[model samples]
Target: MAHEPAVIAALDVARPLVVDLGYGARPDTTVEMAGRLRRVAPDLEMVGLEIDPARVVDPRDGVRFAVGGFEMAGLRPRVVRAFNVLRQYDETEVDAAWSRLRAALSPGGVIVEGTCDEIGRRCTWVLLDVAGPVSLTLCWAPEHSERPSDLAERLPKALIHRNVPGEKIHDLLTLADQCWDIAAPLAPYGPRVRWRHAQDLLRERGVDCVVTRRRMSDNVLTVPWEAVAP
Candidate 1:
């Protein structure tokens, strides 16, 4: 949230309401998200929603717990973080799910929907606004990923099956892996340095990427949705 300008702007609204959809049986992640977002919007409200009523627990640490799903529990929120939810549904159902979530958003709202490994070493998510998906972001621990394309297993449902020959996503990942190999000379400096050099190579090849201001602990790649649209 702190790194994305659109997300920060969404939370800066007069009455910012953020929802952690499908926050699982434990509320630990929601609580952590609340703490992190409070730095950007101290007055922002947070709620953790789960489809299973039994999973919803007592509110704690300023985060309300409730039973809800893609409809957002009838509450219009400014920001929604829905990780590992759609991965359970069929690819054909993804559009409907996204539409339902978009309909429940407040004006200028945004949604971060994605999937990640159990320990979150690799993640891929799509950033969406009222109109539709804006960009796709891939994040991974440098040591956990052999090549940028290795994170392909973590792609969200929408594009998970689209990573095939002739697909834009496939092309992007292939190009990224090629760049990683080309940057092998920098590997002696460490994975982080080599990954940064690989990213530089990506840009040099005319792939538009979101530039980060400071050194990041993980390798991240973000490109506009059009670049990988199926």
Candidate 2:
């Protein structure tokens, strides 16, 4: 749910929405995403693209499938959600993959890429406008930890291996944790309340953050990539 809203939102403005570079083996998740997006953007047409031709399924309805990588999906879509496919890829190759995905967008479209823990409880993703990476989104269940720093454990592929000292991501997450500590008294009010208040403080203090009440309700927070990168 890290970006279910954003995805639905994008589909509202663009047509022939599709998800490229999905995981190789699972059709179930693709099916789920197709239905969810269709519900919000009734005119949407989703195509699940995969590198393995055989893994791609020519599904029965609303959703379609193609055998290809980000490089040549033979499609132009409004949105593409590529999750967990790059954790195994070297960090240096990320930009190229993104370039290819962005190439498939129709004018003002997007490529939402990121990583997530299985079962979808904790996750992080990046939103790539046709131009390039614009924002990084973090999603998790507040029930996992009373402190906001717990999100650091679910870093997306780009920041996952960069959580060491001297890295920007490390600083952002650590500082967030420190702020969470100072706001601990709010914990008595509840994680959601404390999180909301803490996020508000960060914004007032000039943190470049913009989040919806919906995202907050979904237990997510986001920062620009420059704010938290190695």
Candidate 3:
């Protein structure tokens, strides 16, 4: 959230409210996210929601817990982090879920929805606003990913089933693997460096990627949603 310009802009509003939709059986992740976001907007309101009413807990660490699902507990938040919430639902239900979540957002609000591996070595997410999905991002620990396409399993529900042949995502991943192989000589410099070189090669080949100068702990590739839309 702190790194993305659009996300930062959305949080730079008056009385910003952020929601951690479907924060799971524990509130640990919600509490941690509250602290991280507080650095960006200290006065921001944070809420953790769960569909199971029995799972709701008392407010703690500046985060309020409540019972909610894709409806978002009827609270329109400026930003919503809905990780791993849609994985359990059928792919056919993704659109309706997204519609519900989008409707629950405040004006100019954004949603970061995605899934990650159990150990979080691989992850993928989509950035969306009132205008709809803007970009798709793939993040993974370089050492854990033999090729960028290996993160395909972690793609958001909207794109997970679309990773088959002839799809834009399949094409992107194929090109990424090709780039990674072509950048093999950089392996001695470490997988992180090799991954960045692969991304650079991708850009040279006409892929529009969000290349960042700052070094990140994970290898990240973000491209406009249209680049990988099914």
Candidate 4:
């Protein structure tokens, strides 16, 4: 929800809406996101979309529920957060799914789709605008893992299987572990320090990435798709 402002500003919309796709049977998460987003975009609206009309929760807290899927219920959204919605689909269907979702976005809107472990200790998401996927973001709870490569188990479905040897994702994860090992000394200070050192090592080794100092504090690393695309 913190990214709401940027999305709204980019779209030049006065009231930006966030679509929580495939939110399952519970509307709790949608309601929560709406509350948090309102803090930033006071007029932000939240809509929960589900394929199963029966799964829709009763609307409350300014979060409305609707029956829909990749079609997006005919509403153009500024950001569509489709977390864990594609894990069951074959990887071959990813591109088409992205296309459907992208078609429903307002100009400058984005689709943040990804998979995350239970409790969100580990996660990977792709940020896509109407053009295509822009970047991949890996996020983790600092104390949950020792090396950044440990996030391999949580990669989004699009690249989870590509983590095997001979693949770019494999090489990236391999380098991440190697870099973390080399930055072990920084661990004595804190995971944040060690993580930053590990990220620096990736840059030093020419691994393409977008370094966000503030985001690094949240245990996140956003890398360009070309760097680890399979």
Candidate 5:
């Protein structure tokens, strides 16, 4: 499940992990998020902010349900994971949302915004900091491999619309696919090896890079914002 403890372990923890901009359609994910955080960071508190106040039920210790937007509810947190929360917004509005969320972060905070297929066969998200965009990560298991750019079809609201010609996101995605193609021989080494080789290739080719032993195991290749930014 997206909000499970194992999944939450991959996510960084903060004092108050807030799931800003949840849905009226379901609060189940928020509930799971709280449970998972308590497992990973025992002292962590979670707050779910829903613009639709009706969705927020009775609150308890370590978890507060509030009515707020993607801009944040005047709470500074270390981690904010907003999944499928911005799928409907216009691209132009994405920046404002990011600005508001980043502004509300506790200095070193990170915001992960993305969408996953109903079953999570394929998922992608962007990581941002106070300095602005950082990287776009497309996580997919290739049992159903199409072109890597198929994910371009599912870019976040900010980038989905920007996947056209002359876009940075477009260029970086293409580069990712190209890296995959060039690193095909490494596939014999295992997907993880091939991926690491591919990422190394990116850095060698001077794509601003960020890769760690921990991140690599997670199947994430975090590149510079300019490489895949909108």
Candidate 6:
């Protein structure tokens, strides 16, 4: 959620519209998103899209609803948040869905696709542009996490089943776990402190860790797609 501002800024649209793809039966998620986004972009609009016709709700202030899937209702959204939607499809279908959704993006748009635990403590998502996926972001509550690699269970579907010994994602998580162990001494201060040290270790080992000072304390890490691509 911290990166939402960056997602909005990248839109470059005066009255940007963000689509909550497959926003389930409940309209609460879409409504909350609009309220939060309006804090940054007052003119922002939110549209909730669901495959189930019954899930569509009446249009409300700065928010609307439509029945559609990957090929959305002919609306070129500046940002698409497809949380946990792809998990229901086979991994092989991901590319096709991404292509279809990417085609629906307006200029400078992006698709945030991924999954999170029930309580929303941990999350992993890919940031996709017209060219394809550019980065993978992992976020969690540092104090509640066991290790950096523990996020593996929350990885997006595209990479979740590919966490084998020789896979790139596996390699990254293995190294991250090792670094977390080595930084155990810093744990007394708090997990965030230890995580910062772990990140430094990752950088030292040539892992492409992208950290921003403003969000560093958020316990989030963004790495280039190539760094952990399967």
Best by TM-score: 1
Q: Write the per-residue lDDT of candidate 6 for residues 77-157, one digit (tens) a residue.
A: 888899889888898998999999999998888889999887678889999998999889888887668877878988988
lDDT of 6: 0.85
* Candidate 2 backbone clash number: 0
Q: How many pairs in model 4 have backbone atoms within 3 A of each other, for residues 3 or more apart or on separate chains, i.e. clashes?
A: 0
TM-score of 3: 0.96
Give the TM-score comparing model 5 with the true structure, all chains together.
0.77
CA lDDT scores, all candidates in order: 0.92, 0.73, 0.90, 0.83, 0.69, 0.85
lDDT of 2 by residue, 49-159 (tens): 788777877675677788878764677787888888888889888888888888878866777798777877777888888878778777777776555556666676777
Clashing pairs in 1: none
Ranking by TM-score: 1, 3, 6, 4, 2, 5
Q: Which candidate is the best by lDDT?
A: 1
lDDT per residue for candidate 3 within 31-65, as digits (tens), equals 99889888888899999999998889999998999
Off by over 4 Å in 5: 1-14, 35-40, 58-62, 214-218
Q: Give RMSD (Å) of candidate 1 vs. truth.
A: 1.0
Model 1: which ten-residue window has the lowest total lDDT? 209-218
Report how far residue 29 has shifted in candidate 1, in Å.
Answer: 0.9
TM-score of each: 0.97, 0.88, 0.96, 0.92, 0.77, 0.93
The candidate with the higher TM-score, 1 or 3, is 1
Q: Model 2, stretches more than 4 Å misplaced? A: 1-9, 214-217
Q: After superposing candidate 6, which stretches have Cα over 4 Å from the reference?
A: 2-6, 215-217
